[model samples]
Target chain A: MPGEDIVLRTEALQKSFGSLEVARSVSIELPRGARHALIGPNGAGKTTLINLITGQIRPDSGKIFLEGRDVTQMDVAGRVRHGVTRTFQINELFPNLTPLEAVTLAVCEREDLAGQFWRPLTAQKAAIDEAFDILTQLQLADVATRPTRTLSYGQKRLMEIALALATRPKVLLLDEPAAGVPKDESAMLFSVIAALPADMSVLFIEHDMSLVFKFSSQIVVLVGGGVLLQAEPDVVRRDPRVREVYLGQAGYV
Target chain B: MTTVSQAATDPHSWLRGQSRWSYFEIAFWVIALLPFYFFPTYLTLASQIAITALFAISVDLVLGYAGIITLGHAMFFGLGAYAAGLITKAGWGEPLTGLVFAGAFAALIGFLTSFIIVRVRHLALIMITLGLGFLTLELANAMSWLTGGADGLRGVDVWPIFGWFEFDLWGYTAYSYSLIVLFLGVVAARRIVHSAFGLSLRGVRENLTRMPAIGSPYRFHLQKIYTISAALAGVAGALLTQTTETVSLETLSFQRSADIVVMLILGGTGRLYGGIIGAIIFMVARDQLSGMNPQYWYFWIGLLLMAVILVMPNGILGGLSRLAGRRS
Candidate 1:
């Protein structure tokens, strides 16, 4: 059983592809409601780790725990139903559906109404209201009726977040949420992230140091397929090893 | 603030302003009623179009909405035909009962087969579906005593629908029965496509990778839709068998499967009415063109299909909808 205080915990997670070790005995713990940032240089297995946690790929020999329950054996959908959800590094919104339709699906799924077929989706007034409420919170109400494909890059990124948030997830995993957005729009995106409910735990992998420094309460640095250092944001910022491994390469003092 | 309040009260406002009845749908119903008045002698042809449209709609559910390309959907249709035919031959000839039995049997087969079919994707899915069709065809052919061999199951006698309306020579009963079934099927399919479950199936089609992340088990939803499609296809088969009073090997042929796919593509995909419009256009064209020259009818059909494809790559209805500035 996972401890009550820790919402998500990985124990000695390891993965390898042929001769390459992408993750080696990596262990991390996320406390309840913690805002954590995972930062690493390129090729440091950040994506691979996110994949393992979300059950996209299995870890060779390790355990994953969610809310004190072992979920290492759970599939992606099972993990999601258990209140874990994630956004793609690249946008994965349904191009044919409007943002309202897409987010409504997420909301309906969370409400256990995804199997309903006999009634019109519009009849789910409460789900629609909840979905609209989420869109409003994400500042996407104006464009909710437009097809997702027509949205600008930054809007799509936020739409992806809206999709994730609509699941009512206890732990949200964001994989490079601001990867392709313009720098100017990314600030708006981060501000929205900063405004998420306080009880929701978040683990995000990002390349932007400014957003990382401003948003994360705690920072975990990954290097060479293993955890290099995990500490409070300020300590991680000032760590010599962290500076040598990441800040040095990215020209951040 | 008023917009939000109006949206809350008018529940349908959330559907992106799409209405249930479009001019096209209204026109379709009007056209469906035409055979009863103008050409009573051509009721058989109208009934055939209705049944074929039902089959095409089944294909659309999987191919258009769920994105599972199949080349052997006729297996379910044929199974349903055989089941209904056998039931009538056994002296229990209630039309509705036979339809239910046939549909359920076909759904059972679909449920069993989907375990393997849902595991593969792309070319492998097509091959497996095609193989299943052939396998069932061979089984039917081998069971000569039961299936009547290549000559086909014969002497199927259907009881009058509800013991009131008799199957008649002028094809009035067949046409009305088929039209009613087609109407019910269309309503059900439309309801499904507009539901949350339907949306998830589209989600699976749009991105298999992201469906599970959003709490939809990919294989489960595929299996569910596949089974439902098979059941509906079975209903179409049952309708055909009951109307014609015969079940033939042609019903199981790969060509039948391919024709339905072509009809679906000809109409449009992903849209509920695409298959219905496609079947009407394809069958009507085939009927008229084939009457002109039975020997080279395929040549004319081929030319017409080529023209349709070249002019509207998305499909006939898809193109028309675009021209009308309607959101698909």
Candidate 2:
């Protein structure tokens, strides 16, 4: 893998809650167009790491680089404007808006029309078309007019992806995209993920090993708030240390 | 599938397909026109209703759509009233010019305050707004020479509408002027709420966290809306001052702010016509009830309010919209 093509890089990231250090000297590099997976046991600070990367919470120390531009000091909106976007572990959608409306809002924001108060949103022909395209691609076209709150868990998850994609992000962080979906539904979700543009890098955190094994090109195993291993999926599956720490109990190796 | 394509092809399809102007709006206009004929004697009260409705709509813009809780909105209202009144006192009593001065002055103040206001949320926002309202009230009271202190600014002589229609005791000119302004204000507000900016505001209200992730600067949008809302409120105040031919410290009072909020809630929040409907019902009801028994009228008003809150928490228009099976 060419490391020089890094799209997202974290250097010695550190964070603590009171006395408990959740992230300690954590450094990660995700190359351009990489399909990356972050897997760790509960309390291994996976969420804390994501928050640090997204600027939801500031890390005590270290820097975050997006395409070699230091975004460590950027606020959430600033980072998003720099083309970094993420989906929540739980669906965070505008519940009252239909899928079409929600996606249209995202599209409008992306098109820099977020402040256009004079023209009606429906008048934005290109935005509406693009929003519908995104919804259709995510397999949410059937329920485009239905309010998001009324959607199924699987549909909501897809809508979350659609919202994130609407921003046309350079790097998309998906926090447990299949978290609440059934096994059969997750297959559909993963397929949609797999169909994403080849140039867009994706970093996801998932507990489901099958999905993880199938989706990620590279896997980073986190243990005790530190990187235990980083390798290709096949290599990670066979590693004895990885087996001893994680895969051994599941007997996946 | 065809609907999507059609929506894309015809730009006005989305605008026309949606029920923007329903019977409620039509009924509001009809009722607004009624005071001109049947109750010509009460044109003064009608003008008051129009002014109050405009103020309530301003409150609704922020509180309803943006989910910002404010308790000191009268700061802008009073500021506009004083600005307009002071201009007239200075012998520059051009009604149109005074209106512009009031709106711009109020908008300037709103823009300055929003830097602080948009930084906080929920209870802090409410308290800060309340504090601002009281602060302006005190400032107005202390400047007795300028604001006439607690006694109120009096002897404000407004120019006739278009330099022709003098404001008579019958309040015909004032009522018509206020109604026209109120109509324009509602049209502008309707345009705003239907626009992309308004959708982003709703998005922010629904999920603050998700908004920034989607590239919306939370404080920026809030501040923008706050300024727009304040400008509208100021216009309302100017209308009040112009019609009443007076500016008073009560315009900036916490009571004024609170009452407008209550009226907005009673009418419904978020909906374009909520404030107008709320203002009409509230002012009309108050006029009737207070006329019956001035001292104990509030007791009846309180009882009715409690009943409305318990039965339809969304307010009169919201409940009515629900009955009509339309989204409030």
Best by lDDT: 1
lDDT of each: 0.88, 0.87
Give lDDT: candidate 1, residue B143: 98
Docking class of 2: medium
lDDT (Cα, 0-100) at B281 in candidate 1: 84
Q: What digit string (tens of lDDT, one per residue) describes model 1 on residues B1-328?
A: 4544455444348474453666778898888999999999989988989999999999999999999999999999999999999999999999999999999999999999999989999999999999999999999999989999899999999999999998898889999999999999998998988888888888888778877888876687788889999999999999999999999998999999999999899889988688888888888888898788888877877787789989999899888878876542
Prediction 1 global C-alpha lDDT: 0.88
iRMS per model in Å = 2.8, 2.9
Clash statistics: count for each candidate? 1, 0
- Per-residue error at B70 for model 2, in Å? 0.7
TM-score of chain B of each: 0.94, 0.94
User: For residues B163-248, could you state the per-residue lDDT of candidate 2 as single tens digits?
Assistant: 99888899999999999999999988888888888888889888888998887776888999999999999999999999999888
Q: Could you tell me the lDDT of residue B178 within candidate 1?
A: 95
Kindly give the stretch of ten consecutive residues in candidate 2 chain B with the minimal lDDT sum: B7-16
